[model samples]
Target: MTDFLDPVLTFIADNPSLAGLICFLAAMGEALFLIGLFVPTTVVLVGAGTLVGLGKLELMPLLIWTTLGATAGDAVSYWIGWKFKDTIKNIWPLYKYRSMIESGEEFFKRHGGKSVFIGRFVPGVKSVVPGIAGMVGMNFTRFSVVNVTSAVAWSIAHIAPGVIAGSALHAISQISVRLALVLGALLFIVFLSVMLGRWLILIILPLFPNAHAAIARWFSRRPDRISQWIGHNFDPAHPRSTGMLASTIILLVSMPAFFWLIGEVAPNEPMVRADLAILNLFDSLRTPLGDKIMVFMTTLGDGVVVTAVAVAVALYLFAKKAWRRGIGFVIAIAGTAIFVPLLKLMLHRSRPMELYTGADAYSFPSGHATLNAVLFGICAVLIAHERSRWAKAAIFSVTVTYVIAIGFSRIYLGAHWMSDVLAGLLFGTAIVSAFAFVFGPIHNEKIGRLTVAGIVCAVLAGFGGWHVHRSFDAALVTYAPQVHKEILQAADWRQTTWRSLPAQRIGLNGDAEEPLVIQYAGSLSDFAGLVEKDGWVRPPKWSLSTAGGFVEGETPPDSLPILPRSQNGRQPALVLIRNDPKTAKGGRWVLRLWPSRFEIMEGGTLEPLYVGSVVHEDILRPMGEFSGPKTDRDLPDADNNPARLVPGAVVRQRPGGTPVVLARRPEQPGLASQTGN
Candidate 1:
């Protein structure tokens, strides 16, 4: 991926004029009527912003070109609408999107002059609003004023996120390239998911009214009692029909899936193996930062947090004197609370890790998962019951994302298996749906949806914050990775026992990575002292001051920080780097050491074993202004240099002819040196 991106970035840097032109065309294409629908202008514009942040492209020129292109595109669209106002509705492609045109017209009428500005940021209607305004003979002066200002705001809104992201990635790469990449991928995925969800909802929702009408027609044509009964209960004209039908469908689907999951988990089927595989995968990917994030997410779904929110919402509903609605809300929460524990008792499944004892150890249906799902699921239904399609889509999207995050946190933290979380979500959805279907639509007109939503959010922020702050430390300790230790006699380790250790670093996907080129039998401090004597220096730790070095672009190669790499989810304990000025662009040789599980027992004292790798990195200045390090694949010949510098250091060869460096602190005086291939 870096190989592919490097050349493109280089070309952009070499020809700034051409890059600006491309940005202009992309912005224009994305704003043009109908053509804008196919052009991925937002993504292209964001990419441009990223290049700016990377110092490959100047920001002001690109922003100016993009703004002009957008303004021109809107003007052209308005001209077309005005010229063909009488026949526009019957035009070939325009006729096909009659519904969108009509929707845009209605939006324009409702918001008046403001729609011209507001619609530029809205997804479905952004491309058509300008045309609609012209067709309706809106004041051209007003349109121009709104158009120019909105185009500027829209461009900034879309591009600023990318700029921030690029700047963040650049800083993080200095600490760990792998971490930067992981975080980048996660952010991109989240952005894509949100856009795709919104688009899907917008496209599919318009078809629902037609579908309901068709289904109603079909039922009318039929004479069967079952068809008549379903038609009457699900009639589109009825106030509560849509809610009842949707809830019933969800209940019917979720109940069976929940039972099937139970069956699969009980029999220890293929899903069980998959659960373990996923657990191991997450275990490998665990980092200190990731652990902290997952812990915070999991805490949001804790029993105390969810219960507090549920109780707050219930009280608010009762205060508004909405008796039936309050009762249904209570039933959904109470049912999930009861069902989760009952299932756990019946199945008695164990968590991936023994983080808890007694009743808390059982993990068939994750209480955290079930409680949060129930709380948010019902909240979405209640809030969206009387809202427009757009409001409903936004509400459900947020609710689903939150619930999924909580469930994933449980799995990532090793508190529950994947199947356990899945079962819990399915069961929780079933409970919420069943209650919605039985209770009909909630009516609390006196309490606005926004008011209810605001109260819930406020309580969650205030109460949940306190709970997490109190419990975060204990949660971290409980979820920390388990370590195992082994001891071997110093003589045995020197002879043959060393072969039992891992030969290569393991990646997140369980793939073999860099080979372990050196093994030292000494304390970390001793190893550091030996290497420091040879002119090796520890890289400066990451901080605001150090981060500024990347921007200065003149920091010596040796002063620049080295990116840390992980082996089996563990970061290096000791790192040292030495400048290599012989390379054309200047280079550096980095040495990193990770402590092993094994210890060498030398008489009364125990010396730890360390395994490490060495590599030479060449400086890369793609744009000549911002520089980064690029690692060379072939191992440098300096592999044995560190051990050679140590006093009384011994070297031996492994079976594959790779060299292993061995050393001991002079203070420990018990080892017999014996070496063989």
Candidate 2:
């Protein structure tokens, strides 16, 4: 496949004549039944679009050919339905399509011929909508009008990009094939991620209840003073055993498979960035305000901060009260907020570029994937309970569609890796299922913290609303760094080595060259973090970043760059935290990166800067430290940061200049400090 593209690109580069035909075939093949299913036509569509942007393909001709093919395909599909609607009902492949036909019928019955236009987007109906319209005996004149209007819109939606993408690729060809692919891929991946992310979230959400149950069970089982305290106060009958046992089974059965898929796929190709580009383009075109409306699309669901808020609204409308609903909603969101980053940290995934972009971080178990699963899964569960089948079906459809859309948002936003989202969905669904069984609505709360959960959820929701009311993006900052690379001696053997173990070749370069290579060390953390760094950069959780070879007159290895010590835009900046003893795990630390002003002119170009990186050891005194607050001030103060980190190692590119400070052990009762030193 790699062998196939270069020559074609070269040919197009010279001829410029064949570009339209190539795109035409691409569009036709994409529309052709069964064939289009295998190819993931969208990839080719964008490739062609990029070619157009590069001037290799003419926009009008390319759009015209592709549009014609798409229109023809729809027309053919309509004719087949009109002619053989009954024959298809009993035919092999089409037999199962009866349900689809039925669905299209209902949709049209409900929305009239307009369903033809809307159903084109919906799966199950994409190919069959036109046919169903024919089967239902819509007037030929009306159908023609609808089809032409819809087809033009669909063609533009599907094909305009190949033309422009062609141009963008042309625009940046000199940037290096890897960078160009990575950037273009970033754009496209972001487009598709949020939609596809739903599937992954569905899988994982079902496991949430299992995790919560386990947490309850573990807290009870501990013979420790804290366990006893929690148990005595929080209620002894909280189903701790059930939660633990279920969690153990899930860990054994599903977690391993989830991680393995992540290892094999996420880091290898990572389609998130490329998918996002397509999504962004869709948003720009679909949104009445275009890119300006992205503000609303991304923040659309931000209103439902706590499960309680959504739960309250749902129940209030239904005239009912259900604590279990709140639990599902709250835990689902909390789990994603807490665990996704930890997973990303454990995985330490890198972003799409040699130099990290704004969205790059540890991305496994995407928040969108996790939360969307919970979000829509709850909707599905709610629908699943309705007395009417039509009601259930309606809710299920909306839920599934919603999950897909949110997942797409994440991908489109360039916030998650493909597999990250995939893993998130699977795990999320499993969790939601488990929770639904264990904590589904009960008559009472004798065995759980349902009361606390409700209050906590409500409080959180209100706080989230306040943040929205005040301004969610008030603290948000964005940086798009183009990291350049150097092999540094392809054979340099004595490069950076991990204290953890043995690997002869394959070192981590933060985010390196195209087809960016990181030795698969097989540890869950290295493997996951290797792929999803884009969404995974919290402290205790590390990710690939600071990728650049020092140019002439840049800051020396020993000095930190100039950056504001205090930042107000976003509380969680992508800050680099150095951990030598590696105690910073779990969900204790909050990390944020604050990028410095860019300087196009060398010397004038200040190094990238970050602030407010807190390692667990720095913020909290372990039990051994006599349990007290720090008397010292916070960092970028000289008194504080030097204890656990070297600022220069974090501020910019200093690969071997990687600075790691060993965690200081607390003074033991009978031993002197020099005993360890």
Per-candidate count of clashing residue pairs (backbone under 3 Å)? 0, 108
- On the 0 to 100 scale, the lDDT of residue 370 in model 2 is 72
How high is the CA lDDT of each candidate model?
0.75, 0.45
lDDT score of model 1?
0.75
Candidate 2 similarity to native, TM-score: 0.40
Instruction: Put down candidate 1 lDDT per residue, 9-51, tens digits, no spaces.
Output: 6767777887778878887787776557666687788878877
Model 2: residue 526 alpha-carbon error in angstroms: 36
Candidate 1: where are CA atoms >4 Å away? 1-58, 61-76, 79-97, 109-115, 134-149, 165-193, 207-209, 220-229, 232-290, 342-349, 418-440, 444-451, 484-677
**In model 2, which runs have C-alpha deviations exceeding 4 angstroms?**
1-19, 22-47, 50-56, 82-85, 104-123, 129-150, 160-187, 190-256, 259-320, 330-426, 433-677
In TM-score terms, candidate 1 sits at: 0.63
TM-score (all chains, Cα) for each model: 0.63, 0.40
